[model samples]
Target: GVLAQAIPARSHPPSARSPRMFAWPEKRGIASTVIRSADTWQARSPLIPHEAFRWLHSELRLALENFDPSVPGQEWQGKAMSEWLREYYLESIHHHHDAEEDVYNPWLAALGAEVPPSIASDHRELVATIEVCLGLAKSLVGGDASAASSLKRELAGMMDVLEVHFDMEDEYYSRVLVDFNVTQAEEGAAVGRINQDMGLEGCRVLLPMVVYAMYAWGGPEVVEQFKGNVPPPVWATLESDWLDDFFCNNLRVIRRLQGRAEPELAEGA
Candidate 1:
């Protein structure tokens, strides 16, 4: 059985006296520990983050198509396209890349993982583009029904960047984390680092976004698996306001785009 411990606050040589800490945290601490094998990590592909990438890109495509045909449905069902981009799209991805840098990059680098330089460059370019679009989205307040073709074209460009970036990221994760035999403890640290950085405030939006993405692309089993990997409290939202406010409303825009039925918790995801 693996002896679990906290993630080290700083790196140290993996000597018997000083080594990297890797454990799933619990209320009483690492006193009673149980760790799954790499098989648990291997059961998934591109890991949890990549799952969100797939679903979010799918959502982006839906958004772009809906907006392309004249931006008609602004008021009835859910958020306006621009509003969704401002609140969710721009921020969600921006934070995702940031977390990868702050959380995953150090650990992966230490593990001798080979990451392509392009992924980091893609993240920077994508965030800059998204920030500019965020400002445009802000101006188009109320998901402005009269949004111009120029804005729509901006979204198309965003979708192009987003879609290509997703494939690149997925490839990177598969090559680095998946085939490289990342330990369950290491994976646990990655999850732990993500949860810690997101904190409760960030989780209010970001966690639900992850849950929604998992629910949409991966289904119930997949969503449950994803939920289990993170801190349990993130999903334990009182009344699930996170889902209704952060996830469902934006998802409704996608449904409205397709002329589909309004969202339930199921649809919201």
Candidate 2:
């Protein structure tokens, strides 16, 4: 039941094959690369460009609110709530930061002969935080109530730190990286490497979930940018009829939680 248990619908697609891909195509002029063999299929790596980060920021903000216990179980369960936090904050978020450390930081370091101390310090801090969060996830999973409570507290602290961290990133991106004329091709190449490293199936599944979360947060402009950058083949399954319907419905639920369509902020929004 671990697999079937209360895992949140993956915010991005994971490596799994969805039935929707079988019938859906042409929805976005990105249907030519349909994955015919799920077994041999590999997934694309998740790379968050500057715009993608902003989109994620929006989505996470909404997700935290909606997943908070103040909202009812009819919306999203406690286990799923915890899983969502673990998946995004613990896994995805850390990986994204690691990407920066691996790729962008090195580039900066090479240019300057030394990486900025502030950035280095931030990376160390993030490493420490990720370690603590990994433990917290384990504790929560182990059913330690006191640990869970403490973990939640730490999680909240991490969230606060994350807001600032992401803010710093946004500032840096606008001030410095934006001037580099970083192209989608360059980023895509990096993403391709990451994806190949992650394997095709893994990439396929995770990218969609993260992409959806970004869209749920960043709105249409971000989505367009995402589509523009991602290879056409990577999205063949996601653009299918079933997934389209599914993702839309999922968005509505997210909106309800985040108070998107409402005249005012809805439930958690």
Candidate 3:
């Protein structure tokens, strides 16, 4: 696999405390567990905000970890990783920003509060930064070792911008959504529209990524929210097909890089 080729096995044995740190199957089960634990979908608050942030943070962290310039052979390895991250950034973060600007912002403006221009400007800047990173990644892939350092710098800059941007967007939007008395159904519908716009192929990739991020960073509340929001068949396909194949492999590489233990999957799952 691509991940296995990139990240070598750890020299030290897995410790009892962190037995499954890099364990993909165990983490995959977390999503299943979250779904199974939910008895109902009674909670009606919008989950898009929390889930978006979770996915953004988790994806960025994973990219940064792998993009670390100090890591040997990052020049070549980072090319593929960066390409993957670029696609994710576009499909998730960029898509989210577009949705906010196109749908949420206009809707809120109609309701009385116009979203700040600074947020839109931030999106533009972030888009440029992502392009720079992608360009650097392309250069690295073309055998330019020096481009690795530049790619790392761009990724760092992107992270800084995103941290501020995410906070600002969340605070501003949360307040507006509250003030406008937007219903959970409305939010869900908006997100559903956005997903539909993304098309089937996009969902095939993004859905699994979303689930993976939810498990990684969403904690209990977010997990419950995800379980509530997502349908059973959708969740099943994401878990069994997409996640088990795609995300789990990459996550295993990340765990190995972090020197985490690989936990064993449960008996049945």
Candidate 4:
């Protein structure tokens, strides 16, 4: 419900209506459609694009820690975490795919019919993998550690699948950027560019929010690898007001579930 509402249909409004000229290109007694590029006008926004990973990462880490032997809440906690994983599955990952489907796929399809089809097929495959993960999630909730572990093993198998998926996406984006001269715009350069480029921004934004979200959900090394990119001022800002808002508003939910609170901040927030 909350997740359903979280992903709005349009992050930004389109510039104009469809034109008959672009819609139906003419050849010698033949007609074709010219699919315009999926202009990522809102896609490149600062806060929202990164927010999904942040939310999912935090939630999933809490779920994993729920599996900890020392964790107090037991099956009850596991059940709650299971619900969260499912919510995140539907919200973060699924919603993201929908964006690709609606925007990226159509544009790529315009490039060639096969392109979108191949890309669309991956959605189904990912759904299948998620189904397996869901089964593991259920077992974990039911207190079936063995079953859950088996599912996790299978889920781990999909890591290669997922990585390849991301790789394909990166390739797709790279190609699109080249087409549009938007490689620089595709990713915000000059701002945390080094960390992301060299993979060092992790060190720059090492607050609990960044750590559990980017590192834990994605991978520890994803952030650890980015150890230097976060500029001092950015880090200072994150440490202060941004962090202050995150914890002040959300710490209780995370803490009650055995997550570390905002006990440590790099400096301020």
Model 3: per-residue Cα lDDT at residue 49? 42
lDDT string for model 3 (131-239, tens) is 6776876776566767877776777677767766765665566556667777767766766666666654555556655654555544556666776666555555454
Q: Count clashing pairs, candidate 1.
A: 0
lDDT of each: 0.56, 0.48, 0.55, 0.44
Query: After best superposition, candidate 2 residue 131: deviation in angstroms?
Result: 2.1
Predicted candidate 2 versus true structure: per-residue lDDT over 48-106, tens digit per residue: 33333334445556755544443344324344445545553466556666767777667
Evaluate residue 59 in candidate 4 and report its C-alpha lDDT on the 0 to 100 scale: 51
Write candidate 1's Cα lDDT for 1-269 as tens digits.
Answer: 01112222222222221111111111121110121111344445443555455556666666566554333444432246666666666777788888777777767887888667887888888788877777667656554444545566776787677667766665566556666788777777776767676555555556565555544445566656666665434444512345545434555566676566655432222
How do all models score by TM-score?
A: 0.69, 0.58, 0.69, 0.46
- Model 2 error, position 124 (Å): 1.8
In order of listing, the candidates' clash counts read 0, 21, 4, 11
Off by over 4 Å in 2: 1-78, 111-115, 178-184, 198-206, 213-222, 240-269
lDDT of 1 at 264: 44
RMSD of candidates 1 onward, in order:
12.7, 11.4, 9.8, 16.9
Error of 4 at 86 (Å): 1.8
Runs in model 3 deviating more than 4 A are 1-76, 216-221, 256-269
